[model samples]
Target: MIHLTLIIVDFLTGLLAAGAWALASAGGAIAAVVGSGILGVSLFRRWRRRD
Candidate 1:
């Protein structure tokens, strides 16, 4: 009985860790896309102003 409980706990911990990793990866991707977009717009505006 104790062995079975430990197995279940380990499985749950692994599942939670995988979920957290996926969430973090998705958030990082979104932040990178937004950051690049902002950078591009800033550069475009600065270039136009110089002309």
Candidate 2:
């Protein structure tokens, strides 16, 4: 019974860790996309001003 409980706890911990990792990954991806978009727009505006 103790072993089974330990196993369940370990499994739950792993699931939580995986979920946290996925959330961090998604957040990083969104940040990258938004950063790039802002950079692109800024560059575009600069180029247009130069022209």
Candidate 3:
């Protein structure tokens, strides 16, 4: 019984770690996309003003 409980706890801990890693990866991707978009818009506006 204790061994089973330990196995379940280990599985849950691994699952939680994987979930956290995926969430962090998604957040980082979103941040990169948004940052690039903002940079692009800023550059476009500056070029437009010059023209």
1 against 2, candidate with superior TM-score: 2
lDDT of 2 by residue, 1-51 (tens): 999999999999999999999999999999999999999999999999998
lDDT of 1: 1.00
Off by over 4 Å in 2: none
lDDT of 3 by residue, 8-42 (tens): 99999999999999999999999999999999999
lDDT (CA) per prediction: 1.00, 1.00, 1.00
Candidate 3 lDDT score relative to the true structure: 1.00
TM-score of each model, in listed order: 0.89, 0.96, 0.98
In model 2, the worst 10-residue window by lDDT is 42-51
- Candidate 1 clashing pairs? none
Using TM-score, give the best candidate's number: 3
> Which residues of candidate 1, in runs, are more than 4 Å off?
none
Output the worst ten-in-a-row residue range by lDDT, candidate 1: 1-10
After superposition, candidate 3 runs with Cα above 4 Å error: none
